[model samples]
Target chain A: MNRFLWLVRREIWEHKAIWVAPAIVIGCLVLLMLTGNVHLGPFTDMSGEAGLGVVPDDLQVKLLVIVYAGLALVVSMIMGIVGFFYSLDALYADRRDRSVLFWKSLPLSDAETVLSKFAVATVVIPMVALGASMVAQLVVAAGGSARFAIEGLPAAAMWRPEALFGGFTVTFLRCLTAMLWYAPIIGYLMLASAWAPRGPFLWAVLPAVGLWIGERVIVGSTFVGDFISSRLFGLYGVLSSRAEAGFEDGEGLEGLRNVDLVGSLRDFYASPELWFGLLAAGLLLLGAIWVRRYRDETS
Target chain B: MGELIVARGLGKSFGSTRALDDVNFRVESGRIVGLIGPNGAGKTTALKALLGLTRFEGGLSVLGLNPHLQRHRLMQDVCFIADVAVLPRWIRVSQLIDFVAAAHPRFRREICEQFLARSDVRRTSRVRELSKGMVTQLHLALVMAIDAKLLVLDEPTLGLDILMRRQFYETLLNEYFDEQRTILVTTHQVEEVEHILTDLLFIDRGRIVLDAAMDQVQEQYAQVSVRPEHLAAARSHQPIAERQGLGRTHMLFRGADRVALERLGEVGVPSVADLFVAVIQGARA
Candidate 1:
């Protein structure tokens, strides 16, 4: 385990360019919080929007919630991109730098090598991103609190300034839960790195596009739209429509309408869509391992 | 007394072309065997097979472990430096050290540091910033730190100049080498390694052409430079290879009577290059 951690640390330490993508994403989030048109004062003060004169405290809280959720989504997407490269680049970098020979010369096995890459992509990188998000949110939340306190607002609302830190932590956990949902994709990228001779990114991404296109072409005779929708988002179009209805009619998290954290995790796991992704990812990874095992060093 | 490595009738092919053909070799503990071959020879393939880096049709073993079935175990006892110096260009020296220290149980940090200290390689410097010679040094330092039984280096100093090559050999000889540690070094520069080699194997066209101790090879082979008038006598002796230069005939003879050759005409010690050419041609014939 310590050796695995060292592998992750080495990857993090060696590729300084990798840090740049996440830093840029985090920087953008901070920049948005600092300069966005939304009233920062209302979010800072323990007081709700009831005193703001225009918007109700509950409504203000909902807007803030959306903003925070959007921030989390954007951050997660950035990490996906970064994490994808992290996983994919791990194996190829050795070949690129010719260090494949060096590392292979070590006592480490191919399984260990591939697994360490998976661990970094699935576990270590998310932890780093989460830590960064926590620090960034605290600074942002603290600044807002100071602003709200100076304004001396009369009535507090549903948005709790104290909960911002809690929200950050919860969001990180949610993203981590979401990563379990995407583990195979991360693994697939790794396999692609091992399998392809040139442009692994293209190798990784092109297949999804090709499959989508192939699905459309194959289904053009019977159910064209259904195939397109399923390929676009792993969920069936009708099921997604029902889920969205449930979300909108939701008291939006109050009065028996709230999506509990564990419930969300359960719902995501129960979907056949997630299982299919896992299976597809497994096959891709197996293929990649096969390529590595028999790879010609001369090439 | 156990063998550290063994290969029997190993063969590899790329499409219709055979890259390695029925090559057999072995290394026991406490010996430095030189793997000498010309360009396009199967030296790299044979080494890669031993390291489990490439797949071959026949049998290969490292420390009694089959390369295919027990590659990880074999790797634990074996180390290899490929024909090229390959290190991550973006990685800093210090970070590389930390990585190796973390990954391998046998990696010796103190030894690596000592080697690094002797040179001007900066801890913060990225690999891309270093020269080819420096890269070789870095590679050697890392591999030397691993306490493996077999150390296989393929053309380790391909791009290095004389001074750098000398320094590399010196460091390898003084710091890391021992009889208990078996080494298989492949090189085109057979002349440079003549003194250090304990045993020599000449490989050509993916086969072992000649395998002999250095002393026996010296004793069995002779270079005879005969006058133009005595050329017929030298030819009658069945020299391995012959050339005419400046009205004199130079020929390399193996298993020939040297004293008789000296009495018949001029005779001297055969250069490794002369011997290699003669051996390769002889094997082909």
Candidate 2:
């Protein structure tokens, strides 16, 4: 376990993007908040509908949740891209620089090395993104509250501890579920990173694209395409579908309040796709370890 | 001394090109064995096989463990510097030390720090920021601190200038080597390592042409600067290799009677470089 920690630390040292990307996103979000350019369209629309033009306490809670989600969304999206490129480069970078020879000289095994990078992608990157987004959320909340105070509106409406706690919990759960859902893709990227002689990103994408096209042209079906889409965007699809279902017949702000983010996540956890993805990720990670162990450093 | 490494019929091939062919050798503890070979002569291939960085066919063991099957375990007591400047360019010197200290149970951090303190490598500088010589110094510091039983080096000083190369071997000999440890090094710069190597294994085209201790090489091989009058007599002894230089015919002989060779002219032990050339050419012939 101690060795494992050092290996992860080594990954962070080599790939600064893991932390830097999320930090940049947080900085941008904070800057946008400070500049007064953050357009809370839903908050403005709902405030206009309230009696006496005061945002209702319940509507304020809903708007605060939206604010948290929006901030978290932007940071997590950037983190997602960072994680993708990180996994592609993790195993490949050392080989490209002929540093695998140096790394392999130590007592650490290939399995430990590969798994450390995997943990950084699946666990460390998400946690960093979550933490960065939380900071961004706090700044946005404070800035929004100050704006409300200056405008002679009720700033206290956004400070309900229970509602704010719930918002944080949903964001945390979303990051966790997204991590688990994307494990297989990260595994595939690592496998490509380990196996590719060069251009690991293309190696990761082109084969799947070729398989999809081949299935369409030769097999006359979209089984591969459907599977790829479901694996790639299935979590977001379920989350958005749940939101739509919750707001189907309800009125606007009330509908937003009714969206069961936690319930949707719970449903996502219970899906067969998540379990199968975890399994595939396990196998792909083992493939990465095997390749790293046996594949000679060609350079 | 215990046998630190033993290999039999060790072989590897890349497609149709065989890098190692039915190779066999053994290294005992407390020895600095130079795995001397020309370029593409499987020097690196043999080191890779021994280091567990490549797979090979045949029985090979280091410290009683099969390198390929138990590389991680073997690495606990076996260290290597694959080549100069192979350290990751992105890591700070301090982080690299922290990592080795954490990852290698046998590594002594203070020893490494002391070594670095005497050198130009700064703790905060990234490897890429350091000169090639400094990078090698840092790598050597890390390796020397590890209390390992066997150290393998493949072209460890391939690109360094003369002063750095001299310092590299001097430091290794003075601080790192002892009877409890063994080192297997491969290099084409035969003259640089000739004096420091206690044993020599001359390999050519995947085969070991000569394997002997330095003392044995000294005792068995002799060079004679044959005068013009004794050329027929030296030729009759069938010198393994001959060249004309300094107004005389210099002939190299293996296992020939030294007393009789003295009759030809001034007799002396051939340098490792001269012996290597003579042996490689003899093998080719």
Candidate 3:
């Protein structure tokens, strides 16, 4: 376990994008909150009393939930991009640089090494993004609280800032849920990383794309497309399966408590989509470990 | 001393190209064995199989463990320095120490630090920040810190300047090697390592051309600087190889009586480099 942790740490040490992507995203989020210049057309804040209010406090909270959760999405997206590219790069880079032997020289087994990479993609990146989201929300909430007090607005008049933390809890859980949901996808990326003789990114993606197209042209149905769609977007399957309340109505002004951003996570957790995705991920990860062990281009 | 490495009839192929073929060798405790071969020879491939970095067809055991099946277990007792491989460029010196400490149970961080303390490498500097020579120093410091029984080096000092390269082996000899430890090294510059080699194996085109203890090489083989008057006599003895240089003939002989050869011309032990050339050319001929 300690050895695995160190391998994961090595991944973090090597890839700055894991932290940098979320930092940049949250930085933009905080900057928007500080100046109160968040204007998103219909979801604008109603509080002109602070100044020219473009985004509503409640909607902005939802937007904050969105941005916060969206950052989770963005972070997960960035992390997905990061993970996909990383998985492809990790196996190739070591061999290309001939550093595979260096790591191989260590006592850690190839399974442990490959598992550590999968853990980084599925576990560490999300945790870092979650931690970043939590921090960003806390700062924004605290900064908003200070600004409201200076403006002489009573605590009662302000949007409940506690919801930012609450919303981020949901976002944090959602990130975990996304990790569970996208495990197979990331697993495929990792498998391609280990197995591909060249350009693992293409190796990872082309087969899936070919499957999606081949199913359509040959089978003459969108049914195969839907499964690929659902396999990639289990979050939507969880979300659309429910009758969404406040934000789902699409009309707009709702209090901070009304933001049901990650409410579907409970339902998401119980669904077979998560488990099936995880099962596929586990198999793909095993394939990756097997490939890492057997594939040696050095000779 | 117990055998640290034993390989018999080892073979590996990359597509149709035989990278290693029918390779057989052994290294016992406390011996420095040089796996000498020219470019495209199986030196690197043989080392890779022993290290379990690649798979092979025949029997191979390193430190009494089947390398391919139990490589991680084998690695616990083995350390390797392949200059062709990179120590991840983004890792800091301190992080490298930390990671190794966690991954390798035998790795001693304090020993690594002690070694690093003498070098110019900074604890916080990323590997990319270090110079090429310093990276090798850092790599050496890390590998030397491991209490490994077998140290495999494949082109460990390929690109360093002469002085740094000399320092590399000198440090290995002085600081790391011991009676309990064995080293298997493959280098292009045979002269640099010939002095320290206890046994030598010459490979060509994936075949083991020669395998002998260093002393055995000196005893069984002799080079004669053929005098013009004795050129006929030396040629009649059926020298294994003859090279014409400096307006004189140099003949390499195998299993010929040393005293008899001395009567024909100046007889001396052939350098490993020259011997390698002779064996390779001889095989081709």
Candidate 4:
């Protein structure tokens, strides 16, 4: 575990681009918000016809809150972008540079190597981006609010700690859980990087696509479509388990309004499936280790 | 510690082609062994197998551990520098050093920093920005920082000029290497490294053709330059390899005395390159 920490730390220290990536994202978001105009539409029904020229107070407040929340998700996803590159390429870069030999020579095992990569790719990178995004979000929100005030229009709910940090923590945990649950995907990527000769990414993704296509061709089914929908809509087995727990506990959104962040974490922890996902993630991580041990580093 | 590395009938195949076949050798601690072979002799493949970077079908052990099974634990005592150009392009020299310090228990950060003063490599520049020679030196600096029982180098001085290559090896000898540490070096330019080598393993087409002490090989092989009149007699002894040089014919033969060769012509010890060529052709035959 100590060696794994050192490996993860070394990866972070070398990748200066990760530190710079979020700043670029936050800066772009701020630039967009400051120059663009915002709309509230109608206060009564958010989906109703637009009541032009007279923005009701309630309608304006909801729109402001909704837009800010949407922006937060955008920022969160953008911040999480490093995961794809970092996790997918983590094993590859070392082998490419032949540094795997150096690292392997240092009493670090293949299992440790793969797990540290998984932790960095899925856990640590997001945490770093989350912290960076929080700071940048504050700056963007403040600047946009002041600019709106200068134009004599009321700024959106830029200072709602409830909507920003509260939502971010829960969503970040959800993203983390989702990434953990899909550990097999990341494991396959590691395997691809270890074995495949020419195209690691393509080799990793193409088989899943081919299986999806083959399944459809054989059964006239839509498993891939359903799978995509489930991932995006949060209707996977983990989510279903959480829903069941939510039913038993009756704690859905109760603490959301008060921004009792710890309460929200408690609710998240209530699901037994999170532990199950973690265990499965561990197994998949072991599989990655097995593959990397026999992997030809030159390949 | 009696055996630093041991391999018995180690073999690796890729699809239909065999990269390594029935390779068997051992090295003791405190020796600088040279692994020399032609381009396709599987020198790199054997090194990878010893390091546990690739899985093979036969017996392999390093420091009493199966490299294939306990690579990480094995790595604790072994340091490797595959190529000088392999340091990450995005990292600075200082960051690489700091990273090694954090990652490896045996890495001597102070020694690395001290060597930095003598190296022409900049501590702050990104690896990709440095010239090829500088990159090799930077890599050497990092690997030298680690205190390990074994160091495996595959083409360690590649892409560096003569001066830089000399500096690199000199630093390795002065700061890092000792009687307790063993280094397995593989390179095409054997003459450059021949002076420091205590042992030699000559590989050809995935097989070890010659594994002997450097002194023993020099003692047993002789180079003879004979006139056309003596060529017939010299040819009778079946030397390892033969070639026609300017105004004379040079041949490499295995024998202590040139008594038999006196009937053929004049005899002397050939250069390492000539010996390498002769040994390779002999192995083929």
Candidate 5:
């Protein structure tokens, strides 16, 4: 276990983009908020609905909750992209520089090395994104409270403790589910990194794209295409489906408030696709370990 | 002393070209064995097999453990420097030290730090920022700190200057080597390592042509600088290789009677460089 932590630290030391990318995004967001460039168009429209040029206290709290959630989503997206590039580069970089020889000279096993990369992609990256998002949320809330006070509105509306707590809980759960959902992808990228002699990113993407095209040309079916799309966007599909179901009553924003984020995540966890994805990820990770063990540097 | 490494019928091929073919040799503890060979002679391939960096055929063992099967376990007792300048270019010197200390159970950080303190490598500088010689110094520092039984080096001073190469071997001998440790090194610079090598293993065309102790080589091979009148006599003794330089014909013979060669002309033990050439050429012929 101690060795594993060191391996993870080594990965972080090598791949600074894991945290830097999200931090930069959050920095930009905070800068924009502080500069008064954030135009609350939706908040103004909601206030217009009240016919008093002032948003109701309850509606204002709801809007703040939505703002916090939106920041988390944007930061998580940047982290996801960072994780993608990181996985592609992790195993291949050592071989390109011939540092794999030095790394292999140590007493760490191939399984430990490969799994540490996997853990960074799946777990560490998401946690960093979540942590950055939380900081962004606090910054936005504090800034929004100042704005509300300067505008002579009640600042307490921006500090709905229960709603803010719920927003953080839902974002944390979403980050957890996103990591589980994306495990196979992280594994596949790492497998390519381990196996490809050069241009690992192309190796990881071209094969899947080629397979989708081959299936389209030969079978006149989109099964492969659908499968790829479902894997890539399936988590959002689950979330949106539950969201749309809540909107069946035509509640709009109120409907979003009623959407059970935790329960939808529970449904995602229970799906056969998630379990099968995990299994496939396990096999791909095993392939990575095997490739790393037997693949010679010269080859 | 026990055998530190033993290989029998070891074989490896890249596509159709054989890099190692039916190679057999053993390294005993407390010996510095030089694996001497020309380029494309399978020196690196054999070392890679022993270090578990590549796959091969036939039986092989290092410290009684299968290198390919139990590489990580074997690494605890064995260490290798594949070549100079192979360290990661982006890592800071301090991070590299920390990593080795954490991963290698037998590594002593204080010893490594002490070695580094005497060199010009800065702890905060990335490897890429350092010169090639400094990079090698850092690599040697890390490897020398590990308390391993066998150390394999493949051209460890391949690109360094003369002074650095000399210092490298000097440090290895003075601080790292002991009675309980064994070193297997391969290099093309025969003269630089000749005096330090306790044993020599000459390989050619994917096979070991000669394997003997230094003393055995001294006893079995002799070179005679023959006068023009005695050239026929030296030739009759069946010299393996003959060269004319500085108005004298030097003939190298294997297991030739030293008294007979002394009677022909001035005789002396052949240098390793000369012996390696004679042996490789004889095997080819």
Candidate 6:
């Protein structure tokens, strides 16, 4: 257990972009908020004697959905962006500099080494994203209350511990769901990173793109293209399909409010595509470990 | 204190080229064995096979474990500093210690810290910021701290200056090696290690040509110089190799009676370098 933790720590040490990149993005968002750049004019515009028209009676419910989901969306998306580059570089950098030799020289097996890296991309980084999102949301909430107090309105309702804590809890669950759902993609990028002689991104992406193009041109079929799109965009499909089924036709926001991840995750695991994608990921992850184990450093 | 390594018919090929071919040897505990070979003689390949870094075709065992099949378990007792500098340059000195302690079950942290304390290497300094010699010192310190039974060094001082190179071997000999441990070292600078080795294995073209105790090398091979007039008599002994310098012909004789060679002219025990050349030439002949 400690061994695996150290390996993950090593990954964090080497890839500063993991925390540094998201931190910078969050810093910029905060900076914008502080500088009065986020007016929320369209969302908050109102005219009333007490100026409380900006926040309606159902404003807390709406804000709960919007803030939590928006923060979760922003953080998870930015994490995915960072994860793409991180997974691409993870296995490649060690071999490029011949640190693989040093790493393999340790008593740990190749499986342990590669799996820790996979865990970093899929599991650890997502939790970090979740934490970043929660922190950012809290800061923004604090700012919102500060602005509300400056105008002599009641701010306690907006900063209620229960609502804010519930928002954070919901976002955590969402991030966990999204990252697990995205594991196959993470595994693929890491496989490419492990095996590519150079330019791992090209190695990973070109084959998929070329195959998609070839399938479209040669077979006149959208199967492969749709499969790729489904993997890329399937989280929303998984979340919304059940949500849409549960609610009335035009009630997406309300359906989204009822995103029951545990029940939905059960459905997610039942999907044939999910099983197949995960199987493929398992095979590729094994290949990555095998490559790390057997490939000679000098070559 | 028994046989620590045994390899037989060990073979490996890289594409059309065989890097190690039908190699066989054994290393006993408490001995320092020098694997001396010219470039492309399968020295690195054989070392890699022994270290479990590569797969082989035939029977090979290190510390009673199949090196390739049970590499992770084998690594607990075996350590190596390859011919190249392999420490990741991005890590800090302290982080490197922390990592080794975490990854290796047998690694002792205080020993590593103790070793580091004797040097000027700062705990916070990145490997990239250190001089190459300092990096090697740091590497030696880490390797020494590990309680491994067999240490394999493939040209461990390949790029260091003379003083540091000498220091590397000194540290290995004085600080690391013990009656319970074994050391297998490979080097192109044979002369530097020649005096320290208890046994020598000279290889060429992917095969080991000479495997003998250093004392046996003294008893089995003799270098002699004969006058032009006595050359015919010296040739009767069938020298393994011959060289002409300063109007005298020097012959390297394998398994010849040293007393007989002394009768021809001046007879002496050949250096490891001379024996390496003669053995390779003799194999060709």
Q: Of 1 and 6, which scores higher on TM-score?
A: 6
lDDT of 6 at B94: 88
TM-score leaderboard ranking: 2, 5, 6, 3, 1, 4
List residue ranges in candidate 6 displaced over 4 A: A41-43, A47-56, A151-154, A237-272, B225-229, B245-248
Q: How close is candidate 1 to the true structure, as a TM-score?
A: 0.88
The DockQ scores of all candidates, in the order shown, are 0.76, 0.85, 0.70, 0.60, 0.88, 0.68
Residue-level lDDT of model 6, residues B1-285, one tens digit each, is 599999899998989998888998999999999998889899988989888888789999899999988999989989988744789999999899999988888898888888888888899999999988888888888888899999999888888899988888887888888889899999989878888889999888888898999999999889998889889999999988899979899998989987888889899888899998888877767
- On DockQ, the leading prediction is 5
- Give the C-alpha miss distance for residue B208 in model 5, angstroms: 0.4
User: Per-residue lDDT for A5-110 in model 2, tens only?
Assistant: 9899888988888888877777776788789876665665544325214656666676677667766777888898999999999999989989999999899989
lDDT per residue for candidate 2 within B1-285, as digits (tens), equals 589899999999999999999999999999999999888999888888888888899989989999888999999999999888689999999899999999999999999999999999989999999999999999999999999999999899988999999999999999989989899999888888988999999999999999999999999999999999999989999899999988999999988998899899999989888899899998998
Please write out the lDDT profile of model 1 over residues B1-285, one tens digit for every residue: 568877888899878878789888777788888988888788887888887888898878788888876788887778888844677777888988888887778889999998888888889898989988888888888888889888888888888899987887777777778877988999998877777777888899888998888788889988887877777877888888997767777888889987779865678888778888888888888
- Worst 10-residue lDDT window for candidate 6 chain A reads A40-49
Candidate 5: tens digits of C-alpha lDDT, residues B63-139: 99999999989999999999876899889999999999999999999999999999999999999999999999999
lDDT of 3 by residue, A166-213 (tens): 557766677777678778888888888888777787887888889889
Show the colliding residue pairs in model 5: none
Please give the CA lDDT of all the candidate structures.
0.72, 0.87, 0.78, 0.71, 0.87, 0.82
Which residue pairs in candidate 1 collide? Answer: A47-A156, A48-A156, A48-A157
Candidate number with the higher TM-score (2 or 6): 2
Candidate 1 deviation (Cα RMSD): 3.8
The reply for model 1, stretches above 4 Å from the true place, is A29-65, A146-162, A218-247, A250-263, A279-283
Residue-level lDDT of model 4, residues A1-299, one tens digit each, is 66677778777876655677777877776676567643322222322334312554433433344444345456556645566556567777777666666566666666777777787777776676556656655765677557555555445544556545644654555555546554545555666666656567787678768878887899889988566445434423443344344445644333223322234344445666456656765666676677677757763
TM-score of 4: 0.83
TM-score (C-alpha, index-matched) for candidate 3: 0.90
List, in the given order, the native-contact fraction of each candidate: 0.88, 0.85, 0.80, 0.73, 0.90, 0.73
Cα deviation in Å at residue A46, candidate 5? 3.6
- Note the chain A TM-score of all models in turn: 0.74, 0.94, 0.81, 0.70, 0.92, 0.86
